[model samples]
Target chain A: MELLGIANYLVLFLTIAGVYALLTLGLNVQWGYTGILNIGVAAFFAVGAYTSALLTAPATAQPPGPGLPVAVGMLAAMPVAGILALGIGLITLNLRSDYLAIASIGIAEIVRLFLKNEEWLTNGVRGMAGIPRPFAGVDIAGWSAGGALYLALTIAVIGVVFAALQILYRAPWGRALRAIRDREVAAEAMGKNVLWFRLQSFVLGSAVMGLAGAVHVHYAGFIGPEAIDPLFATFIVWVMLIAGGSGSNLGAIVGALAIWAVWSVTELLGQIPEEPITGFGALRVFLIGLLLQVILLLRPQGIVPEPRE
Target chain B: MVELAQLLIYGVVLGSIIALGAIGVSLTFGVLRFANFAHGDYMTVGAYLVLPFYAGLQLPVAAAVTLAIAGTALMAVLIDRLLFERMRNAGPLVLLVSSFGVGLMLRSAVQMAWGPRTLVYESGIQLPLLFGPLRIKPDHITIIIGAVLLVLAVHLLLTRTRMGKAMRAMSDSPELARVSGINTAQVILFTWVAGAALAATAGFFLALDTNLRADLGWHFLLPVFAAAILGGIGRPYGAIAGGYVIGIAQEFSTLVISATYKPAVAFAIMVAILILRPTGILRGN
Candidate 1:
């Protein structure tokens, strides 16, 4: 019985790690390949998660959403996030990478404001709940079986995304992005439409981030502003990518799994009561933050450095 | 008429705090070529640092503020020597991300130490000093004067001091400055000192204006960045104008929009500036 409980815990961990893997992949497309500094990961994550949850929310929910199929909710999330990216990208993609980072942070805050204040649309601070899991009606007999099935769905999506990104980054389009990132003037001289290419990459990456958010909400079976904290949604992904090898697809998955393990472990340790320290809530964040510093100093390319072409 | 006047007064006071913080942000970015995302936390640390001197030890307000600012400057210098100095050539993205990590560390440390409770410097509020239709706090007046004096001092230092010239030279062209026999390390140290000192003071003033919380500086970070960008990147003078513009705009916006959405006003203005006048109002570098 204890072993069975452990197995269930492992499934839950893998599912959460898989969701983070998606975010890392999305960031890999932007920071790793295209060299765009998008720090607004939370914004897109919130959009996708809330979009799906709101649409699929039960009829009994307050301020009622569409009561649509979970499939519809998941399908619409990507485009909504993509459209947001398109609007911000048109203006900010021209900025120097640092300014772009600041602007993206602003965008995230604005989205948070919208989610917190717009009751009619987002149900305000109460947030949209009652989101159905991927296969809510399946008679799995227990939470463990249902969770395992969803874990399979998550892994399957990760497989498809990993394969698609592997192909995308190897094509001529990928080479041009690298060239632009390495030497923008040179890429422009080579007749590559630099801004246009950047816009496409930004939109594509954000859409994937949206998909990650949807996957996460379905797994958790809830959606709210608190779930998409910037500390988790944005900064953690950056650390995972850097720790795994930014430009490598396999690295994103590995980094997600590794960092999520560290985070979970720290969380467990933080739960232990201590007399002098009342701030156990901050233990994991403080540790993870320190980890980033150590990574930058020692092994910046991550545990698995980007593979040489 | 009175309401508009009151709002304008509030605008000027809030603008003073932002300008102080913006100068630090603008100067650091100009010299270091990276936005120190930890800057807001710099202010937060400053505010917290003042507590031991002022409340715990019962020191005078000015002395407490001075010691706190000095401590924040030292911390910034140590941070630079320990971390940023090593990554001088790591490109902007690495530095920016590292700085963000540093910010998280600072914020989390604060949470650990202080236990995430709202703190105040003084227990009771002082009645506002009225100027016809306007009402202002003594702390607000102090903020405005302090900012003006500090801005003046920075202006003189930049225009008249040799160290200031070297810093500007590096900002304009690193190679040229290197060839000219400037002490690059010394200039970098000075930049951190100046920026962090100002950030600490701005934060202290902000705490005096509003209540103090662990997330105080983090919440206001966007406006400070907006002020820096609005004036022009790498331009301290531009940051001052940018600060006032954003501060006033936010205050006046409350007349039309919900108060809950004040932060978005800064963002909207920042976006507009990025689209229309990317160089900033003062044509910054």
Candidate 2:
């Protein structure tokens, strides 16, 4: 590949990695810090993506979206996703963690089904296209220039989110969250509102995920129901969070990049094989599954273990 | 009245499959104290295992079912020994995540072995048998009978056999059961075998009724989990009742909502039940 080609691919990879980094950080807060097993990460992602797409996309006759500013759509995405997480957490948080997992997955499926079936809203299965790219209307040299600009924009967002999360992680609220996670009954005895704290973490984390989704849809210039595969978008985030060492924002970012690299490498290998495509596709997923098992068995605490107080 | 009866029968048939699947989940939760996310995949494995005997070897239906049951039971035991047994001391969350990994692997393996194309046990559909205003099929009868016999057999084993007593004792209180000199390892093995066998039976019947696909079990995963939770997480009898409730609710939901939303009904019922009575109808430990 030429130098420019390499740089282009590098920018693309970095841009995607930054988006995932946002998601991982969100997950780190929910699962790592607050001990809320949210298995429906894609639901929040979809909520954000669709919210932005409908708001920012050009006025269309079919979906009937209000062709508002992209910034407005992006701004709306966070609270929309947060409200959804709040409602779901309110209903299912009373159950055990495992039950919460099951319920969250159910909600995700329902969200996906709604996206698939509600043509008037999500444009059916075809998905909405022509989602306006950020700064696309600005005077740019070409698509490559726009790509680089988007990459920089994504990184800036990631940095902002990372810094904000780091500050929160060191705050008294974060400590109380950890307290509840480690010893809920004890925390309650200590006069901590355990459920309320957990709910706050859940809402905040999911809002971050929604922000990432809005960024993702704008970057891709399209949004679809198929775009958010839970295995890739949700479980893979879990794998990254666990592998990179949960409870650390920096660790979540590192894990996202590292796991995504491995995932891309596997995809490249699948493409190289001349045999049936499905075989390699299935093999890739199977290997990931095996990797998860091996990781859990060998290092449940992860490589960059959560720091001790 | 006939339409209601028909829906009820259809609901019962679906409930039977879910009940059989949920029993294994409940049994495993009772003995191991963790929700096995891969339980539904075991159903898929069992159904796929039968293809070799029935489709490849062209064996009789009965023979194929027997082989599938044995194979799936053995696979369950092997999985327990290889993956779950080692994690006996791990936290429930860790176990739950591992089960998810196992489920993903099982699903991927099924897709790899048998392409994504859907397959059926028999090519032609059987005409429904009419009795007064009601209509049923031979396969439906078989499913109902098979489910009843299996449930009865499980009841007998749990109540009449020594192993059954050991299992119940262990589920009730594993620490006490161990202190009382019951063979914990033996009971665990028995639990896996029984649970897997029931899962296999459910898969076989599901395949007999509907088309077989790689995602057959994955699609059923939510409903089965809903049943288990509704029935009380670790109570076998509770799962049965939960399964019927879910199935009937799902089938009857079409009257008011789109049929595509049938699965959501299970989720609604489960959440409602959990909120109203966390202990479930059976009050699981």
Top model number, lDDT: 1
| Candidate 2 TM-score to native | 0.96
Which candidate has the highest DockQ of all? 1
- TM per candidate, chain B: 0.98, 0.98
How do the predictions measure up, each by TM-score?
Answer: 0.97, 0.96
Give each model's clash number: 0, 0
**Per-residue lDDT of B59-167 in model 2, one digit per residue for the tens?**
9988999999999999989988988888878778778888887888888899899977898877986999998989999999999999999989988998999999998
Q: What's model 1's lDDT at B267?
A: 89
lDDT per residue as tens, model 1, A1-309: 898888988998999999999999999999888999988998998898988888787777655666788778777889989999999999989878887899898999989989988887887887777777876556655444787888998999899999999999999999888888889999999999999999989998999999999899888877767766775568899999989988888999999999999888877666676654578667668788889988998888888787777
Question: Where is model 2 more than 4 Å wrong at Cα?
Answer: A60-64, A137-143, A275-278
Q: Which residue pairs overlap in candidate 1's backbone?
A: none
- Shift of residue A8 alpha carbon in model 1, Å: 1.5
> Residue by residue across B127-227, what tens digits does model 1's lDDT show?
99988767888888898999999999889888899998888898888889999999988998999999999999999999999878888898888999999
The true-versus-predicted C-alpha distance at residue A254 of model 1, in Å, is 0.6
Top TM-score: which candidate number? 1
Q: How many backbone clashes does candidate 1 have?
A: 0
